[model samples]
Target: MSVFDSLVGQSEVVERLKSAISSAKGGSSSQKMANSWLLVGPAGSGRSNAAVAFAASLLCSESGCGKCRDCQTVLSGTHIDVERFNPTGLSIKAEEVRELIARSAWSPSVGGWRIVIIEDADRLTESAANALLRTIEEPETHTLWLLCAPTLGDVSVTIRSRCRHLQLRTPSTASIEEFLLSNTSIDSKAAAFAARVSQGHIGRARFIATNQEARSRREEVLSLAFSLTDIDSCFKAASKILDIAQNQAESENSERDSQQMKQLQDAYQGTGRSLISGGARAIKDLERGQRSSTTRSVRDNIDSALLDIATFYRDVLVIQSGGEEILNIDLRTEVNEFAKTSSPKRSIERIEALLEARMNLGRNSAPLSTLEALFCALK
Candidate 1:
């Protein structure tokens, strides 16, 4: 298998990257071999995967022949020369960029190139971006920077202009369904359901296919359409939604938080007294970072729930308009009944309300209040 096999529905991108790899290996003065690259795509569009694959290709003797040890190490993030930066906090600070810059100056430990993959390049603060800009402008001979972001607009013009841009499109529903069925144990029906509901996100489709609890949670969210009858019911619905989102976020982050704390403690362990003079301050900083990470996780979980709610209304609108293709095919009976009582106009308005709630959350509004207002509008 090739390294690009997992990049579903992106044949053109795969071919282009393969050509670049071949050109670089041939020692040709080609534009395809760039010192820095900006990978722009929507979430779950496989930007990070593409970057990893490219890194593997650069490190591999056979140009990304997927079965090699070098390919496996790079893809699994165990390669010494491949450094990955995924911000756990709200932003990437200047200090982090400075450290990366210093690391970039080092020659590769084993491979021909030292690859730095930044998963959320858009999270860099202004100072951090400036620091990164210098490194990108005057990169080391054997250094390659691979930055992934949701869009080109997320990065400053200076950074954008200095890097070669690669764009990835969302996979088709059929492509996702096929991948789910082939790679996972899910049946065709479940695969189709997950694919349609995920709206072309491969990770989400796989999650819904493999996780029964996620499917049940989505069903419960869709069922809320039948529950929003009165003001009190709306408030209850909002509270329930927030509670579910928080629970989901905690479930996802609790184990990670515990592991991070343990690592911090182990790093600061000493023979006697404190590990360092300012051990307490160090621990406090770690805790602060954890809090920021948890806040972002909870907000992300809440936004996902809001998207589910919006998609439910979208299904309702589709049903009301006699559209046969619905995202939530498993909830067709209930959606049909809901559509019978709800007008297309009202369904459209409900979707708008959910979008507004998402926007409010993005602006750091109070989650409970934003959700309550959303459910009230739905009611």
Candidate 2:
């Protein structure tokens, strides 16, 4: 198997990267093996996977033999020649980009190319982007930069213009279902359900299929459509939604924070009085970072919940329009009930409300109030 095999439903991108790999291997220079590339794709479209595959192919003497040590190391993020920067906090700061730049300047120790992959280029602050732009403008001979973002417009024009751009489209439901069926032990029924409900996000489909808790949580979120009957119910639904999101965020943060705190303490050489006194500032900084990460995680979870609600309404719109393809197949009864009681216009309005709630959350609005207003609008 090749490294690119993991990228589902991106044949065009895989072929393009293969051609680039061929060019890198002293084949026809027609593809003009770029030193920098910007990977633009929607969430779960495998932008990072593509970047890592490309990095592995470039580093592997056999060009991405999936079993090679080079490929394994690169894929597992243990390759000395490959550096990745994926900020868990809100933004990638300038200092972080500067450190990456310094590392990128180093010659490859084990491979021909020194590759730097930034998973969320959209999260780069202005100064960070500028710091990166200078390096992209005049990159080292053996250096390669791969930046992934949700869209072309997310990154500054100056940086994007200096790099070759590639786009990865959302995979089809069939593609995602086939992937899950082949890679996972889940049955065909579960695979199809996960694929349809995920709305083309492969990671989500896999997670929902394998994780019973995630499926249960999603069910609870989607059930809000049926719960928004009265004013009291609406308010209660809002509280429930916030609690679910908070719980999801907290569940994700606890283990990661514990691991990070342990790593910090280890770096400080102990956990006694002197270590605590010397590491107080670092501990505070880590706490502040954790808070920022938790805030983002809560908003992300809430946004995901909002998307689930929107998809339910979208399914209702489909039903009202006489379409048979519904995303929420499991919730067909609830969808049909809403469709029978509400017009297409009302379903559209509810979807708009969900979208507005997502935007308000993105703007750091109060989550409870935003959710309360959202359920009221849905009602």
Task: Give the per-residue lDDT digits (tens) of candidate 2, residues 1-379.
Answer: 9999889999999999999989988887666688999999988899999999999999998888999999999999999999987777778899989999999999899888999999989888899999999898888989999999999999999989999999999999999999999999999999999998888888888999999999999999989888788999999999998899889999999999999998988878754545557788889989998998898888888888888888999999999999989988878888888899989999999999998898788667999999889899899
lDDT of 1 by residue, 36-112 (tens): 89999888789999999999988999889988998999989899999998887768899998998899889898889
RMSD of 2: 2.0
Candidate 2: regions farther than 4 A off? 270-274
The total of clashing pairs for model 1 equals 0
CA-RMSD of model 1: 2.1
Cα deviation of 23 in candidate 2 (Å)? 1.5
lDDT of 1: 0.86
Best by TM-score: 2
